[model samples]
Target: MATFPQVDFLKEAGLKADRILVPSDADFVARQASYWSCGARSLRPACIVQPRSAREVAAAVRALVSARVPFAVRSGGHTAWASANTIGADGVTIDLGYMDWVRLPSDEEGTGKTVNLGPGNQWGRVYSELALHGLTVAGGREGNVGVAGLILGGGMAFFTGRYGLACDNIVEYEVVLADGRIVSARKDGDHANLFRALKGGSGNFGIVTNFRMRTLPLPPVWAGMTIHPKEAIPDAIRALKDFTDDMWSDPDFKDIVVIGALIQIAGVEQAPAYKKWLEMPTITTTCKMTTIPQLTMDYSQAKDYHNTWFTATFKNDVRIVAKAAELHDQLVKTLKAFIPDGDFVTQCLFQPFPRLFGQHSAAAGGNMLNIERQSHDGLLWLAVAQVRTPEQERFAYTLVQDWVHAVRQFAAIIGGNLEWTYLNYADRSQDPLTNYGLENILFMKDVAAKYDPEQVFQTLCSGGFKVSNVKLPN
Candidate 1:
């Protein structure tokens, strides 16, 4: 197979030898193995380029464009889907793990309202650093989630109810465009169009190096994972529904493990807002007074396993929730039969996607999600399956596909169906960009065309859902 000969273009760009890697290098194996999913870890790229800063990223982009080589950009390598953050030997992978830096507002031009984050910084490190300064940003609830992909794909944060999503909180982005120019995109900046598109636009426009995000004063949270037995699922669903309704309601919905309820009210052992879930019979409770960084670390999942995820949106309805529970039970039974041995874990989560959060996004300069257009308070369902073998992975894929279809079909029957999916939790088989609504899609496409006239990201840098309704090249 063609290998290093094709990677000479990056070397010809005058990149330091240490920044480029071939299969022969020991570091290449380590980098490949570092991905969160075994499927992504197994894809062997022709070469991997590690750029330290926006300028270095710009140089790599220009070289790839000049050579007309297919490429992919990765920050945290957290996406579990194959080729989402990787490429095969036919392409090169731009590994951005080296660009992880957090510049506090004081460290920047004294914009205390915002903090600058390098795309490579994981939420764990970002929160840890920001916590030291008594500040934080609306970011991924999982510590291991990368800084770039989450915001670019429309992140839902612990503070989403109060501050909106991570994308909504982004004040500016320092991006490396297709032409190799490193430009800053802000709501009122010259690249304002690009700025709005970058909010939930995924990787369609350019490689983002730095995310200047609005910061908030750090607050200790009353949050943690509360694991419940299958019997208590009804209580859990009722709690979720009530939580989404923002009012106290009768508890009656029951089936999988329920694991979250974080409130910003500090110094309180239990916020009344979370009394229902807290009252449920639990196997365990990590719920307590804690800071953002600690909460994220506590909730982060184990990586390096073969993982699959699927998601859908629906208005909060007890019947729909019950339908999902039934489907999940069947999926689990199928998985149990499929995997009699080795590591096998699965989760079906339903988080609140309140319309207020969408309205907040619109108020915060708007985003590609257009969630503000939502007419009802909703729940975003995420189905995650992790297996030990490729065969199990395939089986799990088909099983979840059926599960999603059944749930959507059932929701449609009950008038609870919604045409949206959370991009970050989506598997490759799902098309989240199209679900973002046609208006948002068209806006993102126009911005991509304006900022990247060559369509390099569309045609070469392959990964994630494309805003133009076209699938990413394998």
Candidate 2:
């Protein structure tokens, strides 16, 4: 028999959110689509409640507590891997999608520059709104990824070199605690530990209803890929080394060079053959760029939507690239053994870490992110393999993992450590914080314990990153 408590107490608590989805409810099929976390394979919750306001959220939490029922909070349903969304056929879920209300806070600076967004507002919406101000925030690139997941997990953006992770730029968060109390936490305020844990530690603490982030100055960036034939693989690999080395040595040049690769159908049929796109000859060379809009001119032409991507970090040493390429060649050959038709899609992505990127300016006394917050330089490499359908998801994940592991092993051979995993783009099997080292890990766990002494966050919510819950080294 199920031991979980009943959620009927919600009615008396004055919490209204459409209707409570109980286990016997016929809408479970529709409700299940939102479980996109990495561990969604085994998620079966007892009930789901969609609250529209922060007050209702508090009321609902209080009701669940009164009934002694465990529940998970969800924003965009992007954190699919966590068991937090799943109620084990007897737990409850507090879905925040209904709370997607973005408005300019009264306390915002008079410039109308700073915007406070609801946790449900996706990055695309935020970008659209901020672009009107000739401004943008350093946010996730994907159009549909949620604001809550990214900010809570220390989101990495395309312009991180100029600003910092999404978490670093956050100004405030309106959170609902375990006891159903609503509180506003800032860089310097009461429950400062909660503010720090909210950044990068995932939703292991509480449910954040609204997030306040600093905006950035919008600029036309040089972006786009210059595709070359497979024969140019050797030069292309070497160019990866030279380009990263140059950026590291001359950090100011971070604007001039940002290189990444893609592998998929390449023809006018694949994407609209604009004159700029049509101009590239089928040859070997580096593609230089000057604007993002100009570069993504044919984004609608891309084939794969669920493009499999894995990232591995290499040391500041230039020799690591050459070593990585050698391993990359071996992995390519191994994968080729599976598909000899030469129709497979696989490529490496690399970015330079300039000196300016290391200016550790996180909220004071808040989330401690980045393993070596000082002068650590390396190429944040991504292995983007092709994906065409749901069936191919497993294959794509395996190939990406294999490539990252091989590259990390190669880095070890060249005297480099595989530290720092990007939260937004990393695989479920990857441990993002492990790269932060033991001292930082211990610090994060201590912070989590301080804010959530009852262990409500660590034991109840099983989604997102949990520093206190991570498996310790033997």
Candidate 3:
């Protein structure tokens, strides 16, 4: 494969704002060099272009296409893998970090309020800004995750129970095509075909420059986390089902409870004792919540930069929750017996999908989101396997995949409807497009061909969900 080659087009393209950042540029190298995939892995881009405006981004796209160089587009750089943001050999990078401006409409103006975010901006930053006006957009739970990836692939979060996935909330998107044309798209507006294709389509469609989101007035929603002891896995697992069943049945609970087990060696000399003593006791409780408060929660605390493997959905099957808990407990017990002293943490996180509770209670089209198309009567679960060590990491990842597969099987057995997969936390092996339904997937592919007839996005762009790639089994 072709590697990064030295290029001098950045300086020529960058005009008013300090947009184009070449490899040799000190600030560019330091700012755009690192990523958050595992533990701060760094890659050198041959050319890093920071477009201050959508026009600049369009120009950068044209330059890259003319050069025939492979390019990677980065917004928040919070993607779990390097391939999503890092540049290839001799390729250019369209880093959207410089785009962090938000515009809100005053309540008195009667013009529905909305916020425009740059791709590089994270959900946390956006949330903080939105909170100033007592508003909260349905966004990803992890504050550090970028707005682009989350929305493009159907964002999942605590508010999703009442609002729906992130993609479902978007009203319009400002995107630059593979052929260097910039266009605006909305649900039923001009360029609607491209807009529909971009939703849950990953970055395969094009580089989203600025997103025009539909916003909602914020409410005083309660939030909390209740951790069950490791030893209480059996009871905790059972409780998990009861909690989600209540939410699925009532739809007003608006509660998210997570059950996690912390297994770690205490010290060098106490490693063995730590393992023996740490027998599956429930340790963290991050689940008590009612309505949101005026002040925002510390966004930085949402994640600890640890590697996480997760899968989720909205279904009214309590058995899925119970099965996940049981499987997690079994996996932990198995690890304890085999490794004897391995350090690992496993969590079964459950949150309700938005629109499950009720309506937005505010004006429509405030943000560029679509929360109206959701069926709220369901429970969504995420069986996570997390660890810090390389060996433990591999094991945890494999174990989680196995558990999710088992859960999928169990869902089928229980006559549960299996739908879309959350794209942000999806594994490389999982097929998200299929989760969107065969009809939706096929429709997205047809729409994609209309916008990008040459398959420029499928063959050239870096990574994200691709509409043209998924082949359904007959």
- Say which candidate scores most in lDDT: 1
CA lDDT of each prediction against the hidden true structure: 0.82, 0.61, 0.61
Per-residue alpha-carbon lDDT of candidate 3 for residues 1-474, written as tens digits (9 for 90 to 100): 332333445444444336656655777757653455542234566767777778887877776776676778887777654566776556777778888776664543744466777777877778777777767676665566778877876666444445555666777899888787888898688887777767667776778988877777765443343355556655554544455445434332333444432111111221231222233453553322333321134323233333555676756556677677678778888767645666555667665443443244123322222233445445556666545555666666677788888887888787664465666767667766666666667777787677777777776666666767788768
lDDT, residue 368, candidate 1: 87
Error of 3 at 160 (Å): 2.7
TM-score of 2: 0.77
Off by over 4 Å in 3: 1-6, 12-34, 39-44, 105-112, 230-239, 242-255, 260-308, 312-315, 333-344, 353-378, 389-392, 413-419, 472-474
**Candidate 1 lDDT trough over 10 residues, lowest sum:** 247-256
lDDT of 1 by residue, 290-331 (tens): 777887887788886789898999998878888888888888
**C-alpha lDDT of candidate 1 relative to the true structure:** 0.82
All models, RMSD in angstroms:
3.6, 6.3, 8.1
How do these models rank on TM-score, best leading? 1, 3, 2
Query: What's the number of clashes in each of the models?
Result: 4, 12, 56
Residue 144's lDDT in candidate 2: 58
Please give the range of 10 consecutive residues that has the lowest summed lDDT in model 3.
Answer: 261-270
Which portions of model 2 miss their true places by more than 4 Å?
1-9, 17-31, 34-44, 66-68, 79-88, 246-310, 316-347, 360-367, 371-374, 384-399, 437-439, 470-474
Instruction: Score candidate 2 by lDDT.
Output: 0.61
Model 1 error, position 197 (Å): 0.7
TM-scores of all candidate predictions against the true structure: 0.94, 0.77, 0.78
